[model samples]
Each structure stands twice: as C-alpha cells, then as structure tokens.
Target: MFVPCHQKLVSAFLLLYCLHLSAFDFLWPCPQKCICRQDTLEVNCSSKHLTVVPEGLHISARRLNLSGNRLKTLIRRQFYGLTQLEELDLSGNIISMIEVEAFQGLKYLRILKIKNNRLKIIPVGVFSGLSSLLSLDISKNEILVFLDYTFQEMVNLRELNAGENDLVFISQRAFVGLQSLQELNVDHSNLTSIPTDAFSQLQSLSKLRLRRLNINVLPNYAFRRLHQLRTLQILQWPSLETLNSNSLVNLNITSLVISNCNLSAIPYASLRHLTHLIYLDLSYNPITSIESNKLGELLRLQEFHLVGGKLLRIEPGAFRCLAHFKLLNVSSNRLTTLEESAFHAVGNLQILRLDRNPLTCDCRLLWVMRRRFRLNFDGRQPTCSAHERGRRREFRDFSEAEFSKVFICRQAGILERKLQDVMVDEGTNVQFECKVDGYPQPSITWLSPQQTPFSSVGRIRVHANGTLEVRYAQVQDTGTYLCIASNAAGNDNISASLHVRSSSRNYTPPNFFDESLVETSLPPSTNSSAQLSSPFPFDAKTIVIATTMGFLSFLSSVVICFVFMFLWSQSKGQIKHTATIDFVPRSSMGGGGEGGDTGRFTMKLI
Candidate 1:
C-alpha cells in the first residue's frame, strides 16, 4: 500500500476532526432536572417546581422554557453564559421581581414572555442588554403603572402586550424609543386616563386597543400624535361619557369602535376630521334623536352600527353624504314614525336592520314595507304604535278590512255588486239596476248601446235607486249596457245584456176561472160548452194545440221555478229585483205570429 504523502496527511486530519467532534458532544453539560436536546439547541425545564434557574445549562441552547415553575424572582446574570439564547419563556410562574442585569448577556434575544406572573413593576434598565428583542408579553400580571422611559431602550420592539393588568396610569415617554413598534394592546386593564404624550413616541404603531378601562373623558389631542394608526378600539369604557372636538382631530384611522361608553349622543365634531373612516360602531348608547347630516362627513364610510340606542326619530337627510355606504343597523330603538325622506339619501344601502322598534305602521311607513323583501332582517315584524288598536296588530298582518278602517279618510270604493242579464219583448219596457255596496254611496251612470250617455237618450231614464229604464226596449237595445258607479275614492263599472224578442200577440193574458169549475168540474158536454168557445177563427186542431200548449206551460213553470231557485242560491240572498221574468215557449205564440219562430229564445217580464 504505497500512498502519496498528501493523502496520508489528509487522512490524519480527518481522524483528528472526528475525535474533536466526539469530545465536544460528550463535554456539553445539561442541568440535572432539565431535558436538553443538543442537536436542536433547546431545553425544557417546565413543571419541575424549580425555585431558581439550574446552573450548567448547555451554552449552545437557543430556546429555554422555564414555565410552570415556582420561581419567585429573576436574579442578575441568571443567563450569563447563554449569550445565544433567542427565546425565554417564564410563563405560569410566581415571579414577582426582576433584578437589574437579569438578562445581562443575551444580546440577540428576540422574544420574552412572562405572562401569568405576579410582576408589579418593570424596573429601568432591566432589559438593557437585549437590544434585539422584538416581542415582549407581560400579560396577566399585577403591573400598576408605567413609569417614564420604561421601554425606552427596546428600540427594535415590534409587539408589546401588557393586558389583564392593574395598570392605572401611563407616564409620558413610557414608550419613547420603540421605533419599530407596530401593535400595542393594553386591554382589560384599570387605566383611568391616558396622558397626552403617552403614545407620542409611537410613530410606527398601527393598531391600538385600550378596552375595559376607567377612562371617563378623552381630552383634546389625546391620540393626535399617532399618525400611522389605522384601527383604534376603546371598548367597554364604563365611565366614558364625553369626547372633546379635538380629541381625535388628526388621526387617519379607518376603523373606530367606541362601544359601551354610556354616550348620550354621537360626538360628531370629534369624528368630523376622520375623512378616511370606513367602519364606525357607536352601539349601546342612549342617543334619542339623529339630526340631519350628523355623520355626513364620513364620505367613505361603509358600515354604520347604532344598535341598542334609544333613537326616537331620525331627521331627514341624516345619513346623507355616505357615498359607498352599504350596511346600516338601527335595531332596538323607540322610533314611532320614519318619514319616507329619512332614507332618501342612502342610495347604495344593501342591508338594513330595524327590528325591536315601536314604529307606527301607517301611510308614512309604506315605503319601507314595500322594500321589505330587499332588506332581509331578522326578528318579529314591526307593529303600529299610534293608538290602542294599532298597537295590537303588526304591519305585515294587516287585512283589507283593517286597512279600510285605519285609512278611513279616503273616498269610497265599491265592495260588492251584481250584474244580471235581462230579456224583454221589443215593445215592453225593461230596466237594469247596478246595486253596489260602497262607503260614500256612489253615484250611478249608464251608457247606451251606442255609447251615448243615458241621460241624453230620450228612451232611457235613470231611477233614484240606480236603475236605468228603457221605455221601449227595441231591437237596438239588445246589446251590452254599461253601468258606472263612482264616488270620491274611485269608480267601478258593470255591464248587463238586453235580449229583445219580436212582439207576439198570441201571448194572451190568462182569464180568471170560476172556483166551482176548479173544485168540481164536469166533462165538457153542455155546461162548459159556452165558456170554451173559441174567440179567434180557428179549426178543431185548436183544441189539440191548446192542450199541448197547456202541458208545455206546466213544464215551463217548473223549469222557471228551478231557475229562480238557482239564481237565489247564487246571489246569496242579495237580490234586488223590481220585476220577475217568465219564459214562454214558441208554440204558445199562436200561428202567424210576428217574425217567424226563430227557434232560439224570447224573454218576457212578469
């Protein structure tokens, strides 16, 4: 095996490197109770009931989790040798104090979480060495106040959460040097008032949440320095009642929510400067009225919520200049009447919620009722609140009768009527009556078959009972006749057909028979021969014709009775007839009657 000299030297160097790596792996020391993974440079000493940081931790560890422990204090130089530590989690511990130089040597630390601890105050210079810290969470602590320059050294801090604390005040310059800070959440704290300069140095902050505080009034220029703020939420401020005009006069926030503030009215002047505002929520207030143009300055506003307000009325043009507005929620109010012009300016509204209001459902609110299908809102239908009767009924449940009663100031309209056809001989007179039921007793007018006014026609006459009588119903009158009934409200019409027949002399009147003949009549031999003599010139066939005609008349009488009963049933007993009608068959008209037997029909009045 003759190898080159350079190959031999390389082989020796490889063996030495392997030995050095093994020695380094075996020499790294781990704390007795903690588990260390040298490959990942991570350590977990959680839930060990450890009172202090164990010594001799691996210097290569980057993440050290010491949560769920009994550690009471974080002493100075606790992590002296672990300069490469990036994350330190001391959450769920009883840590109350953090001494100076506690994080003295870790310069590259990026995240530090001390949540759910008993920390009362954050002393100055406690995080002096951690210049690369980006996120710090001290939530669920007993922190009372934020002293001046408390976070002036963390220049690269981006997110800071100090929520669920007992913080009462924040001194000016508390966040002086946090140049890269983006989100600051101090919600669920006891903050009474925020000094004007508390957020003066937060030039890059965009989102600020200060909910559930004791802030009573927002003074002038409270948040004027936050130029980059886009979202501001100050919710659940129990004592907050008033806001000055200059409080938020300079910010360019897009979303603002000031709910549950016990406000009586909208601070329109304070919000007049937010031209770029889009979403505004003033819910849970006691606002009674909405004057016109109250929120007209928010041109770009899209959604406006005023839920649970005691709004009684909204002046016309109140929601005027919102060009891109879409949603409006004014539910749970005390509105009695909403004029049609109230929503005349909101052109692009897509959603509207007006439930739980004592709205008076009348003619003025008909416009909203017409658009009920487009505005799909939840809850029961709105009811009328004008008088006692109006209160018992919902607007959607109105019937024709109910509407007539409520809107009685209008004119009359025909409700019920009948138009029956009449038949008469050409020389006889016939009448047609249009009996109608209306409120104001409408006037009646008739038009002849030629469309000429009945009053102008010589043969036609109108009666006081709305009946039109034609003295002689000639063949020309055998067409449709129109009857018009009119009043102030409106007009209605009905038409009747007149069927005229040629005059027939064979239709003779029946003579009275003797009572003795009807009770006990003898055969036609001697006693009745004189009474049965023919009056017209006829042969023996007249007897057969008369007997047949008598039989037919009997059948016709039965048919007429059936027809009369049917008409009575169909009319429901509301018939108002001045005369009765009788139908006679063609055979009853003797031979050589006028106008040959048409074999169709001839009407008669009895």
Candidate 2:
C-alpha cells in the first residue's frame, strides 16, 4: 500500500489497456471483406467471391449471412465457433458435399437456408444436432432422393420447404421425427405419384402444396392421414386426370384448389366428403358442366369458382340447397344462357361473375336484369352476345323498362293461316307447312290423326323447319293432322285435313283458292251432309281476319292484367311504380332488399 507515485501510474495504464482489448475484441478481428455490425451482432459476407468459409468470425455473432459465395463443400466444424448463431444462410453456393457433424455445435440455431445449391445427395446426420431448428429451406437444389432419417434430429422444425428440386423418391421414414411440422411444400418436383407413406408421417401438417408434379392420378386416401390439414392446393398438374372419389375421404380441409389440371368434369364424388369446405377453386380445367345434386352436400360452402373453362351449361339445381353460398364466378366460359332456376335454391348470393361469356339477352336473363343493381358483378358487368339486339352491351347500361322491351319473351304463334285441305291420290306424297315464331324459338311437335306423336322415322317425318312430310300417302292418312309449337311462354297449334282417295278413282286436285271446286271435288262415297257439316268453313280471308282479331284480344287482355297488377302492387306499397321509364339508382334503395322497392321498375299502362 506504500508504493511510489511513478509505479502507481504505470500499473494504472496497464489495467486500462487490458480493459480496452477485451471490450473491442469482436470488432478488431472481423473478416477482411465482410461487414460486421457490432451493435446488432450481425456479420454479412455475401457476394464476396471467397472459396472457403471466412476466418476470424466473432464468437457471439447471432446472424451470419454467407450467401452468393463460392464455398464448395462444408467440412466438419465449419461453424464450430458461432455457438450462439440464430440464423445462417448459405444459399447460392456450390456446396455439393457435406461431412457428418458439419453443423455440430449450433445448439440454438432456429433457421437454416441452403437453397439454390448443387447438392445431389444429403448423407445421414447432415442435420443431426439442430433440435431447436424451426425452419429449414432446402429448395431449388438438385437433390434426387430423401433417405430415411435424413431430418430425424430436427424434432422442433415446424416448416420445411423442399420445392423446386429434382426429387423423385422419398423414403417412408424420411420425415420420421418431424412431429411438429405444420407446413410442407414439395412443388415442381419429379415425383411420379403421391408419396403417401412419406406424407403419412407428418400427422401435424396443416397446409400442403403439391404443384407441377409429374403425376397422373391422385389415388384413394392419398391424404387420409393428414387429419389436421386445413388447406390443400394441387396446381399446374398437367398430367393429372383422375382424382379418385375417395382421394380426399378423411380430410377436413376448409379450402381446396385444383387449378390448371386435365379434369373434364367436376370431381363431385371426390369433394362430397369435405362437408366443412368453404372455398373451392377449379379454374382452367376442361370441365364442361356442373351436374345437379352433386354440390348440394356442401352446405357450408361459401365461394365456388370455375373460371376459364369449357363450361357450356350449368344444369338446373346445380347450386341447390347451398344456404351459405355467397359468391359464384364462372366468367370466360361458353355459356349462352343462365336459367333463373339455377339460383333459386341459394339463400344469400351476393356476387355473380359471368363476364366474357356468350350470354344471350333473353327471358332466361330477366331475373338477372331485375337484380342488376342489387347484385355485385365484381366491377366487370356481363355483356350480351353478338346475336342479341343489344350486342356487347353491359347489363348495367340498360334500364329495367328498356331491358324488358328489348328482351321480350312472347308466346309461340303460328305465322301462316289455317292449312287448306289436301285431296291427294294414294301412293302420292303430301306435305304441310307450319311456320311459328317466339322469343325462345318454340319446339315443333307433329301429331298424327290417331293422336300418336310422329317422329322423323318411318313413312312420317318432321323436318327441322316445322314441316310434316308424308312419303307415300295411304288411305289411313285421310284424317286431320295437328302441329303444335310450344315454349316456356305458351303454346300454339294448327290443324289440316288430309283426304287420300284410291288410285283407281278418277280424282282432280282441287284448287285451294276456288271454294266451289273444293266442295265438289269430294269423293262420291263420302256423304254431302258429312262434308257440309265440316266445322272449318271459313275461307282464307275470313281465317286471316279471325287470327288478327284473336291476337288483338290477347294483347288487350295482357294489358288489362298488367294494369291491374300494377295498381294492386301500388296499393300494397310493395313496389314503386313509375309513370315514365327511368333507371333505378342503387343509392335510392336500402340494403338492396329491405326497402319497399325490390330494384325493379314497372311501366304504367297509358
């Protein structure tokens, strides 16, 4: 304690020097070309073009990024000093070989990324001691196979991304100890089929993506053991054709997407088991139709999407009983008409996307026109087909009154007058013409005198233009024939009598314009009283006059009924009647359907 003053000063200087060396130890020996942030404890040696792992790394470095380097192989104890490192990225390297225990002392490493490398095989014990690793990304590599117990030591790994690899085979126990893994991605692999045995080990997997695999069929119970899986996406599988009905048998997923595949129809049977499914996307497949009762079992389904396919028609009741269904997108298909009954069973549909389709503007779309303002079209309103009067016009551009007028659905009516009686000799050919018109082009049906329907077979034939042709008229064909034209609106009919005489009798064809010759041309055996008692005594002019009067009467009756309904609707205050044609603005309505107005307009009769 009684030292000299000069000696005390020298001792104090030595002590200060030792403290400075210990405090700046991690900063002085930093790698030559690497940037070391002492405050954050991060060392970045990326893109340095070094052929080996750099020396002089700090012992307490928490994150080390050595990506985009030229390191060829990872020898044992390559990172033996960085015991506290939490994240290590060795991506974009040429590391093809790794010795056992290469990562021996990284006890607290949580994330390891070694992607985009040229590693062809991973020997056992490559990841032996990384028990605390939470994520491992080995994608974009040339790994050919996954041997058994490859990742058996990473017990706490929760995510594994092995996509974009040349993987063709996976051992049954490749992922034996990864019980806590929740997400796995193996997309763009060369696997020939679903590795069911390998996948069955991941009992805790919640999301899986298997895209662009060289596989054809998804066998039954492929994912039966993935009970905790909630989302499954199988995309860009060009060779995938058949999805067995029991493929998703025991799954409880909420979202399933199978896009860009070779599916020719909806896999209804395969999807029937996912009763809790909420969203389904089957876009860009060759599906042609949505059959009835196939999707009715998915009562909890909310969104159904089938865009960009060869969908020509959706059968009636296709979306039946889906009470919670909200959105349906079938845009860019070959659909001509969407029937009103298709959405009759849906309880609360809000959006319907039918754009880029060849939609015919007709009565089948009347229901859509009425609810154009109420329903959301996803900002891409549907346009009419080129054949309609309002070609390429958006549904939102037309007012309700204008739409009703342009897209009229009239009852079927025969254009020609009553057919004249025909007196032909036996073995002669006869024909009767029936021209009709309607909005939907009613179907033509021919009925023989015996009340039996005549088809385009045997001696009787019905032509495409609504013509009834008799090849060889016989005596049995000497009765009244009827032609009926019918559609959803209504039906119309016309009748004509045919008199076929025996070939032996001398007969002269009567002129239709000369009434006297028509009356006298009857066969002698046929009684005059019976001929005069014919109910069709009207001439051509008279028949024309009667048809015109009947049409006028029908028009008046329709007007009267419409006026009565309009008055009644106004009295009940359920619908808003307008004296002039005007668009129903969306802002005027309350909650789409809560107000008295149902977003429809009525034209008051003058």
Candidate 3:
C-alpha cells in the first residue's frame, strides 16, 4: 500500500485519460463560437444563429437561463450530461416544439416561470422526472390545449399560476398529486364559475381570487371546504348581478368586500345576522332605499361608506337602534330635509357628513340645528330665508362655508324653520309658518307623524314666519304637528301643541255699572242713627225707590250665585282634564281647538 509518490501519480494519470477518452467518444462535437464556461460547465453559445443544442459541455452547470435566444427544436437525447440541471426558464427563445422526455434526467428541478412564451401546446411527459418540483408558472402563453398530467411527476409541486393561458379544458385529475398546493392565482383568465367541489381537496389552501369572471350565478356551496380562508374580495364583477343571503353559505370569512353590484335593495336582516363581521364594504351599488329597521340590527358595525349609491329617503325610525356607530357617509344624493328629533337617540354622533345635496333651510330647525351647531366649532345650520319681504326664499345658497357658518355660529341670522304646533282639538286649524332661506323662495309643506307631506288646508294658512294662527281648534288635532319649511340644506320643522280647553262660565258684566242700587242690610241702622238718614230709606217715593233698590240688590245677589255655581262646575271639569294630559289624546284631528294659549320651544335640542 505504501508505493512511491511518482509511481502513484503516473497510474492516476493513465486512469483519468482512459475515462476522458470514453466520455468524449460518445459526446457530440461542440458547436463553433460556443464557449464552455469553466466555473459552471455550461455551453452558452445561444442567439448566434445556431440550429441545434450545443454539445460537449463541461457537464457541471445544473441551472440555465438560455432564454432570449433562437433555437427551433429540442432534439431527442439532446442533453445527455445535464442530469444535474434543476431549474430552467426557456421562455424568450424561438423554440417552438419539443419531443417528450425532453427533461428526462432533470430530477432536481424545483420552480419554473415559463409564462409569456410562444408555444402552441405543451408536449406530454415534458416534465416527467421532475419529482422534486415544487412550483410552476406556465400562464400567459398561447398553448391552446393541455395533455393529461402536463405536470404528472411534480409530486412535490405546491403552487401554480396557470392563468392567462389558452388551454380551455383541463382533464380531471390533471393535477391530482399536487396535494401540497396551498396558493393558486388563476384569476383574470378564461374559466367561469368552478364546478361543484372543484377545489374540495385543497383543504390546506386559504385564498383564491375567482372574481371578475364569466359566470352570472354562483353555484351553491361553491366554496364548501374553504373554511380556513379569512378574506374574500369580490370586486368589480361585471356579470354578477344578484347575491342571496345564502351566497356565503359555507364561508366563516371575517371580511367581505362585495362592492359595485346590481342590487335593488338589501334586507336589514340579511346584514344583521352576519354576527362575526367586523367590517363590510357595500359601496357603488344601486340600492335605492334602506329599510328603516335594517341598520339598527348591525350594532357591531364600525364604518358604513355608501359613496355613489342613489338613496332617496330614510324612514322616521330608520336608524333608531344604531347605538355604537361612528361614521355614516350619505353623500352625492338628492335629500332635501332632516327631522329634528330623528337624531334624538343618536347622542354620540362625531362626524355626520351631508354635503353636496340640495338642502332646504328654515327656522323650523331652531331646535335641532341649534343643538347640532353647539356640538362643536363645526355645526351645520340649515340655510334659511334672509329677506322678510318680497318673495321670501329658502336659504339663498348652499356652500361648505355656509354649512361651517351654521356650525360656528350658534344661530343663523334668520330662523330657517318654525316651531311645530301640536293641537288637541276637533277642526282646529293649525298654521305652521316658517321663514325659509335659499336662492329662491323655499316651498313649505306640512309633514304628518306618518311621514306623509300634506298641502295646507283652508283652516291652516302659512305666512313667511312672522306668525301662525290656529283658528276654531277642536280636539282632533291633538297629535304632534310639524311645520316643514325647506330649500336646499335641509328641511326645518317646528312643533307646538293646540290644547282644547273646556268652556268656563265668565259672566263678567258690563264695565260701566250704576252706583244707585246700594241698600245694605246691617249698615241701615248705623247710618240713620248717626249723621245719615236711611241709606236706602223705605218711605213713599223713597220707600218705593228703596224697595226697588232692595229688589235689584236681591236679584243681583242671585245672579252672582248662579255665575259662581257655573264657574265651579267648569273648574271641576278642567281639573279632571288636567289630570289626563295637556292635550287630550281621544280628540280627533282638528277637533277641540277653541283657542286658549300657544306654547313655543324656546330652548333648542342642544
């Protein structure tokens, strides 16, 4: 074993020479102008107008980027010593066709992104021995159809982006062994809705962007096993027109952004039952009106942005139960009025933006506007009529500055709205007058408790706002009455009451009474005994005058007693009524308004 060092070297040299001769004998001749790089042992003579694979490589380079070169065909057994090759990206070359088993010995390849290349179809078994492959991206190519198991031996493949390819139909079990696949992005491509359970085996998967596709109706339980997913963003889908409450049947997703749909409406119960939702985006839709009771059920909602939807009206008790809400944006709409008491329960309003709408302003908002204005430096005072005479208009104009002025300034120069007057009487004509302000005169309409607009009755007449008169009121108008004066900012309403008072006996005689009939029963003896004769002496003509005076006094006494008795009865009836209510509820519309006293809301809601 201990031979001379020179002898051992000579023997090793001969052995290496024989092996080199044997390898060179079978290998093809190296192409001209091709340089075998010493470090990687790869022949990189591409893009020099060569027609065949460069042979006689150094056989060490395992990876190659021979893209951006011209080579038409991959000859059989064209790469014999490239067994150590792991990954390849032959995308930009002019290579058009390849025979099967083109990569028979590239066993260690892991990832490939051969998208955006010009190939008509991928040959079968093109990647058969690539057992260690983990990912592949063959999207954005002109390949029309795929042979079964185009990725048959890529057992370890976990991700694929085969989107944007021309392959229409993928044979079933085409990617069966890809059990380790976790993420796939086949979006923005040709396939429509997925057949039922097409992704059932991808339990380890989490996210997929299947929106903006060709399908109109989403098949039921389409996402049956995707429970691990947390977010699904269905954005700008052109053909998607409808979505039932059960569309998200199998999803426990935390967030959903279903914006820009073709929905006519949304049920309040539909949104309220998604109890686990913390954020939801429903903007740019065609929902016309929201159910008054719908928004109240979503107590956990934090933000609601309806940027470009067309909302016409909100019901009286619409948002009565949105307790912890923070932001509500109802911009770019056609709303003209707001009720003063609608926000009575919304005490925690921090930012309420109602900009760029035609709002009518008037004094009827003295209460609500004044209170809202006092909230902060930025208060919104609904615009009101400025000039008292000559075609009184609502708010002259609406601007951000005007809205800010209403906020900073506690009161507008003119009370844009009038106080509402509640009447409790039959046929009690209530006139709700308000001085609205705007470019043109604001139109005034009576808004009933039922939220219906009523034109003025002959009994009720509205002047600019100097005064409102309720004539011959009965007990029927006992309910609340609001004088809604509107222009652009919003409508202002004032509430007052018409009380039907029970009739009382007032037998007040004429102011000028004669001083003649004065015959006192106890003072007659005292006045005659001393310096005066009989105060009402009973002599002949004197006796006649005295008797007449006495008779008159007796008659006057009886009349006073009767008047007192009648008054006592009226007072009793009044006491009984006061015990019930200021305005009688049983009173019908405009029933018992027999004019007594009118009350005003001096202090605003603030």
Please report the candidate that would top lDDT against the real structure.
Answer: 2
lDDT of 1 by residue, 306-376 (tens): 88888887877777777788887788888766665655354567776776787655555655566665654
Q: Give the TM-score of candidate 2.
A: 0.68
TM-score for all predictions?
A: 0.56, 0.68, 0.47
**Which 10 successive residues of model 1 have the least lDDT summed?**
506-515
Evaluate model 3: give its TM-score. Answer: 0.47
What value of lDDT does candidate 3 attain over all alpha carbons?
A: 0.56
Better of 2 and 3 by lDDT: 2
lDDT of 3 at 499: 60
Candidate 3, residues 381-450, lDDT tens digits: the string is 2333332331122232333455444422122123644445453434434554555554334456655445
lDDT of 1 at 565: 91
Q: lDDT tens string, model 2, 1-606?
A: 699999999999999998887777635468889988778889999999989999999988999999999989999978988999999999999989988889989999999999999988999999978999999999999999999999999999999999999999999999999999999999899999899999999999999999899778999999868999999999999998889999999999999999999999899889999999999999999999988778988989999999999999887788888888899999999998787677644338799999999987887787788888888999999998844577889998888778666666779989996656999888788999999998777889989998998888777899889899987787888999999998657899999889988875654343337666445644458577876997887656779998999999999999999999889878886554445554545554344443533344557753
Clashes of each: 0, 0, 73
Runs off by more than 4 Å, candidate 1: 1-44, 55-62, 336-340, 344-347, 359-606
